[model samples]
Target: MSPVPPSNGPPPIDAATSPATPTISHPKPNGEGEPADASLPDNYVTYQLSRQTPLPPITWGNWYKELNLLHFAVLGLTPLLGIIGAFTVSLRWETAVWSVIYYFMTAVGITAGYHRLWAHRSYNASKPLQYFLSILGAGAVQGSIRWWARGHRAHHRYTDTDLDPYSAHRGLLWSHIGWMVFKPRRNPGVADISDLSKNEIVRWQHRHYLQLVVLMGYIFPTVVAGLGWGDWKGGYVYAGLLRLFFVHQSTFCVNSLAHYLGDAPFDDKHTPRDHLITALCTVGEGYHNFHHQFPMDYRNAIKWYQYDPTKWTIWVTSKLGLSSHLKVFPDNEVRKGQLTMQLKNLREVQEKLSWPSDNSHLPVISWESYLQQAQSRPLICIAGFIHDVEDFLDQHPGGRHLLTKYIGRDATTAFFGGVYEHSNAAHNLLSMKRVGVLHGGAPHGLEDKAIPPSQRLRIARYNEMSGSGYSSGALSDGDGFMA
Candidate 1:
């Protein structure tokens, strides 16, 4: 719950303390290129970061000396108390209901406030709502907004790699909560959330995180029980420890269960999937595949009735004038994604069986054509089909970085791995991008615009080979060949 290690963070700015009047932009937060509005109030919050990239995922090697004693103790004791309370403790009906209420509120603080709003900057919230969410988030004991969001942002930036704080690739327990106990021995030395480091309110919240967590998480719930129902013990057991335990597990499930099970309707190459069970547990975060693919979109559930209370909560807040500028993925893109997913599913079926596919005389296109399109047209070769993915470079779920290496080259291994495999959706999507089949070299006339063939035999041989009238060994440069 305390401030942890670093990601590359932003420089400080303030409306009151800063020398220049600062602009605010939280909610549509941490995004790049959102034009600063001159019409807004001073001390406005924005989520854009001055420094966006974090250290590579590989930098934070497993250097922890040993288990963190404090984390070890808490992990051990909290569950022990919960078991004892389950057997020995008596709870009034009032206690159970109120405890559920408290649990819901605190969970929202983490998912809605800390995760979506602050960490992802998927929407906009007013200062009052920000304050409300921050306080409740503190009660959830998930660290201050800056601290929580810093780690979360890194998780997005590096994803399933080692740099991710809750990397599900490490295993279920480790991704869930064991990382807290094992601890990181090293730091990134910079935070990827410079936008937060400079926010005055965020800074204030971080400064008082420990005290606020104790007050908001424990004392407040206990006081409500004592005053309302005259059962402080039940309040502490149900609303305090029991509620906290559930919230913690629910949050961790977004990291653990989400990656381990369910169908990946989005990019299946990466860990994580969309799971109804995980969503019900996390109050809407079970749409892990969608969440990972569209982090900036405010809605995890892209459907009308996908059980995303968090999305509904944000929508309601906007209706109540508490939140605004909620971002949603464009409809066309959604449809395109669905189509791509369906295609990938078909690909999986094809891979599992040999269906006499027409490998017969595909259109022979020049490798030179792919070379020319490598940047502008951006093509990738997979299973002998050349796909024009210039439009797909930026839209790739792993970001543009992952696709760059495969430009004008075969990406078969990149798409499949020993322990992992891309979805049938991916294969189908790749197939749709197909422009032509592999040809070793430039075609006739494509190599040279000038010289006409001297003889009919020469022209016939040229056309018979790669065409362009070049010699058979002319493409010895090797870059002309597909990998």
Candidate 2:
């Protein structure tokens, strides 16, 4: 594999850049602000900018892309090969059933477990659930959980930009599968997965990625064939090769097709969208738009009617005490924001229409006019307050509606300034943060602090030892830890 060099232009100062360090301002004596002469140190800005190192160029040998092409060929030719193999050798029904079952099980492990749980932290699961999902995810042969989550997180952080590892904006062929094949860039020092890297399971999976893939993808099938079918060739053909082909394409579709098609009910800043067809193939992960909009949401299909078997699985497991901390976007906030955007679009259309004054005019309202009217309405203001108070009532139980009277009006400025001022809202506004349901507005006072480096090293060592079979700890099944 070869590394691709960074583009030879001024780097874009987008989300892809490292977090900015703020310049501190010291307070002056006499309770006044510091003087303007207290300037930033020389080269401070340049130093900060220099911290944002460009990703290394991706380079690959001719055989790398060629090998990928071969894999693609293999995938396409698998069905034909299956036919040929069937004629040459008896293809058992058990082999076919096993192949299909394992394909779906491991595929869901990647989409539902790795992508949603590990990468996005959509929800917290029990240790056994985590182990089960992580192991299955590791079997997908798509790199380790840490690597996948790192790349995926970066993709979301800098979507559509050159920094995006597999941006669909590049092209279908490139985004869908080419990036994985060529590996033209080694983003050394760019894999910002400090959080997940600290995880022992993730680190273990990353190191023994190939081993896990081979074991789950091939060994398991061989074992099944030996015991059930008594025909190793049948297992190799169906459960091994054909199953691999099916899982690969189905998972890849999320990258290529999921972004290209489907309805975007959430944010539209990027191509991630919801598609029922894609979800069916990807184990209820078709709601890409919602996923992107609320990456922390464990349930992709927030609505009960949406087809999400993976979500159902998680839900049932949670009820059975197999999962916990199931995250979800607040329905009111999601709906309200969507409605606001839609109303804005409608107002824009109304404004653009130049209807004749005398031609049976229906009362068409402009956005600005509507906003002004709504803001002036006392009833609207009262209603908004009432709604907020009611929602918070459950949490505070004994708390009364101190300002329960501002629902439909433009009391946002006052309400926000008064209540949410000292909260994350203030920081977000000051920092000019992008609005998205998935952003997790503030720290929420429930964030887990960074784990100590010493503990991390110990975990890594434990994982290494465990994977090497030196540790006697039995593999955690989905029982104690899952609950």
Candidate 3:
């Protein structure tokens, strides 16, 4: 749906009438300028449903598309050309070093430059840094910064889903290089990257990409090594073809290996993981798990000991005035994510471990606080206890999407009688998974209390008795076990 033209006041209330509280006004059904309800209380706000524009469906007439002939020619032939040149040519160590240098610079151009600086906006680079990085990135044989950034942003936004240009879930080869050769259907490019297009440098590079690649990517490296060092063939062999192959493979591994290998300290809901091998290979992009969790932060490797050269480069450049506004998340938040995930994973082994349920050590939160956790870390309050149900969301008896709706709010009604009328064993499960005690605010007309010790035993017995026979009326808040 298109946007409704906004007015100065919603549910219009004159400042003279109510100084502190603003009233929300909706369109009158009778086509009048006033609000639909004339009996609204003074100083109160009225909220109506907001309209959201539905996205157009993705159209793919065919299920599969043939691999791009040009991509196959370029990628496939590069290795062949490099192997032939390596055998045919006498490549000097100095010439090979030049290729290594070029490889490092170009990799940075993609990792630190295109990935972090442009794709994630993790830091602010000076105009000169951005300009140079943009040029070096073009020399990497990768697409222009504009194109790269758009696809990358989409990869992060949709990530692991079908819309991802290089969704790792598609398979290692597909995420690494197969995506370039073939796709599902018509490409929609990226969803939102107008900011990338605004830069004149990015615009110019995108427009003259063919020229830039031929010069900086191929010819220039060849000529510089040949003329500067008296061996053009060796330059072409080592610094051109071989270097391009290495850079491409290394960068591609960030998409493939980073998703498949290593550990997910941040979240496992998505495929991205933190692999030290990938980080070292991709110049600090190996911390895929952290990157996915905190994409806004410039550092993929949160710790100093971690091998994140790109993050270090950005930091050093920022100190040197080549970059600024280096974004890093708070240490506490990072710790919280780690602890949350750790506890979540521990639940799998919770049956083996004994849980001490004093409820004194756990966090006490308000209803609003519980709601805020639902934004990412979904939690549910039930029977005077708050449980982190993020891991259980998908495997819910009902449905993941259905359970998501009641997240952050109390599910006591649905569990007891409203909807599913969970069995005795199910109610016992809630007691087993308690993370914290629920504090009833003054508004709820209830006092804060920990779950009674005897109630735990009672539920166990209830579950045992229900094994023989069970009835809906027999369940009274799990036999008055509800605190």
Candidate 4:
């Protein structure tokens, strides 16, 4: 149906209408040349036009409504009935165990595999992992990965806007689960999954979505039950129906609780937020705020102790050579970004405070100075090292050439021991990593050109070329120490 336009009202008041105006009058001689009498203010003019109110939004049609009714019956009534029947009819113990296992497996598949890996591209996985996750997601009776990813992307893009396919703003019930019950019959432009649709695997899955769901969900459970308990009914009731119920509700929480209640640490433009409770239930997907903030980072919880089982699984799989390219934000960069945000927030809070004396009550200067000092200190130190190295190399021809040999190496220790051993230089070298001098491909001083150990010894000799007879042969090439 077409959308209704809003009603128009009177012209809005503007700056021009602020001042009052005086009345004017004019008079003329009698012969058909009479002027009008004084007139009242122009504000006295009034015009009103009635406009039709827009009709209400269309509710679900009969067919669609029936479909919703059917869904509710299956999801609600069947599960309840099954539970009651299990107790009343004395269902086998094996059935209950199968059901619990299936429920957990399928739930993990959707939350960890489909949503985290495929939809979000949070991490990479091998073919085996992919197939396992895909099959498990299908077992939840949800659509193919392609369809799920497409809808999810749309959800992220539009969020709470009217264009959002399922916005929580549309009402909790509608956004939580009503969308699936009453499917949008109208083609919403073939879904914006052009990339996914192009893939042969995705296309095949999309076409056979229902078949796969039924097979994996119903038939597979039955087969498992038959194999384990020698009864197909055991698997159907336990693994099939029970599993479906749990998985559906858990997955739906991402749509409901994930957006409705959580702490948003990142961009507030979208509804995504982090909810510990939700994350626990969804198997590490609870850090919605952080996930949305850095969607490219495969690990949702940046910290090792963030309680992210999915991340752990990915890590283990990667170690086992099953997954690759697990994207992660560098620690330094993450720390810097977070620090910047913290400073911004602190500044904003200070700005909002109602200060009484000259707006100088806020203790911002000290804190800002500290942060500046911290950020600048390291940079300055590195810069100074580069500068000193360049200058020393330029002044002493042999010194520069020798230093180039150990360029990629940490000459700090060698230099301190050989030249400034009796001085405080040894103390400075204490903290550096204990790799060979030529550890990282000839440190900053040495470029691609390879230099032998002999050349490096020669450079050390030039550096110890003290003019005031401070020392000579203070350097050494292994045995013949020059002192």
Candidate 5:
């Protein structure tokens, strides 16, 4: 149960020695963009690096050289014990219930205690409650609160970088359990844990972690079953070893499966995601994207329907006077994060689909020029825009003759509702054929009738409406043609 520490690494910035005053700038915890009130304590700690300089790149030495054999051996033995016990030991209903109950206790020790309480300072707990969680966490056999919180803090600060102790970018195995089994050649990025170092309970637990692990992790479970129902063997197998195995793997999935499987609704900049299965496995730590974005928020699954027993436990404890000052990131900021990601996804989809030519790029054609071009090409003016419908003649669902009738004429009224009201799909398709804009708006009177060759007064009206007329000589240049 006493997992070994890394054999070699650089000295971390002593959390106890970090500056007492917060120097790192951040949004006010009130989330209102207002000045901080000195009366209220900050919801989150400002992690500071002892050295201001950027961290050096990790030096990955030979894998075998970095292997933490003792740590690996301890982890490797638990599953074996569970496997052996499963076959040889018969299960008792009492032991099975105890194992399930114990599984939740230890899982909460990591989620509600190690993660939300200490690692992120998402809430405050009473002395007795802290001790209870500390004991339960030790029983989980993950690590001491100080050690576990330190690594988790580093994971958040240097996520996806080499400095991250268990960067998901390294692969699921590396993030889940590989980081524990194999020691890194270089130290993980320094995370300020001055607050953790100052906690009396944390210090006490660290000093007696191994003893607590043995007592609560193994002996206590066996003793409980033995005394309660004379099921000592079943307790040792299911409640002790098998429960530990389940807790270990389920917690590990938060770093591995949670990151890889779900959608990133809050922010896709990080690897964290959200999924129901991951929530069920981790006792409600599955909403990772939101957790990463608003790490100070006490709740992981913010929605009431979401299964976050850990959040529920914290809330219940607060009501019972065991915990208080539960931090929640503002609703406005949470919505902004969700909207930002939605817009980003929409932009990605927009890029994949074809769009019409920009209006700014289309040519301005006088009515005279429109008529000149319509004689040779199937040009039609619709809603002030000139469309070349030569290609669309055969594709027009109504019939080729119907479109041909509008050639060299303004069909704005018909396109709107005169013949048939076009759908969004139809409008989009028509926009693709827009070769130019009519210098003046569509002619209301000229839509149905053709001007006679000798109607000089009507031609003058066309010139007046267009602001300028394009004659044969002006057609080549000095006109709004698509040159």
Candidate 6:
């Protein structure tokens, strides 16, 4: 069925909304109609759900009225029996191994088939490969390819909104499984599935989806173990019901945990995040932030070291002529997204830090005044700046004597190389001690006489030029000077 438009549909039956799921108005970057501020929380950005109205909260008294009977039965009955089967059945090694192998096979059906091939069209698969994935995807029991892909596409188009089929903003439980178990009175926003309709294999799978579920999801696993090694009970319990349970929950994590946890490295404007645990659970779908940002890119984890078995499978299939036309977002563009987030984080840190006063604000003192002020305090003149080094004298790595000897004198040459060439660290530390600037800059006569070529001062750019000088306000008192 084509999705009913959200606006045209009746009010949502809302069966899971709770106090935790507040009616948060769509967040604004800088409190409505202002330019975005990078320092704001992740949600306060351009990419957000544009909803006319919040979905109404659930009426708990009538919660049972909204329960989807078929969905409630399958979801409730299977998991309970699967749990009981776990305790009753003794799992055979053969069935256990098949379950592990089949788990990966079915997972690829969702990731490579339902997700990449049909939903996002990130790649193309050969007819044989398509058939293989469709059958196995049915075994995963997550609805027909057309059904699953339509909802998934809608999820991308309307993420974190009421129209999203499994919107993460509704709370983890609702996103994970409650959306399926309960019926929404309002339809989710529509996604175009014209491409899905054109695919003969998808139509075939949807037509026979129920029969396929019984055959591929249940009977095949039981028969594989029974006929191969006489472990039908183990196969039905462990490989069939139990494996299905895990597959469903793992897929659900992409909707819940992927949105709830981890850092958004690509774009924090949406709910998706990149987390290792989510990747490990979802067979490489854990790089959700990247996936949401570049939906057409076949690979979720773009880095070589990141774990993405789904991407590897697609790549290997291309070599075997089973799949082709794999799409990749431009490397430079991807890097730009990463760099943007890094800069935003740096801006946040920069906001919290203290910086020295600007050079233009410093007081200009005469050369005569500099010599006069030196007698009262441990004042040293270097690189044109008057520094009160009284507090830093004992902390100086060169010892108190070296600093004491330079007091009331121009030590620019000695600081550069005549005594000891200091590190950039020393320059930075000295900058903080600045009290004032010498009139007409440094005393060139005192600094130039007998100073070796290596000891000559050099001007650098930006902060290095002035050594980030600022005053302590105590420099205004001059009564104790020797002038």
Query: What is the TM-score of each predicted model, taking all chains together?
Result: 0.61, 0.58, 0.62, 0.56, 0.79, 0.77
Off by over 4 Å in 3: 1-65, 186-190, 353-483
lDDT per residue (tens digit) for residues 234-347 in model 6: 889988988888888888898999998899888999899999999999999999999999999999999899999999999999999998999999988999999889867876
Best by lDDT: 5
Mark the 10 consecutive residues where model 3 has the least summed lDDT.
471-480
For model 2, residues 318-416, the per-residue Cα lDDT tens digits are 899988888888887789757755655665665664421210111222224334444533222210111112334334322334333443333334534
lDDT by residue for model 5 (155-243), tens: 99788876788889989988898888887634676676667777899999999999999998998888989999999988888999989
For 1-483, candidate 4 gives per-residue lDDT tens digits of 434544654544455665586555444334323322123234321210012232234465554443556556656765785576557544677877777777777887787667777777767777788777777888987678987887887576556755466777767776777767765432221134544555555566678778888898889988988897787765776677766877787788778777777766555567877777887767777787677667667776776777677778778888999889888866676666565556556656656643221111111122223234334221111100211233344454345565555443334445535544323322222212111111122234423112212222222234546632211111212211000
Top candidate by TM-score: 5
What do the candidate models score in CA lDDT, each in turn?
A: 0.71, 0.61, 0.73, 0.57, 0.80, 0.80
lDDT for model 1: 0.71
In candidate 5, stretches whose alpha carbon ends up further than 4 angstroms from where it belongs are 1-64, 394-397, 440-483
User: Residue 5 of model 5: what lDDT?
Assistant: 54
Better of 2 and 5 by TM-score: 5
Q: State the weakest 10-residue window (summed lDDT) of model 1.
A: 449-458
Q: What is the full ranking by lDDT, best candidate first?
A: 5, 6, 3, 1, 2, 4
Instruction: In angstroms, give how far residue 158 of model 6 lies from its true place.
Output: 2.5
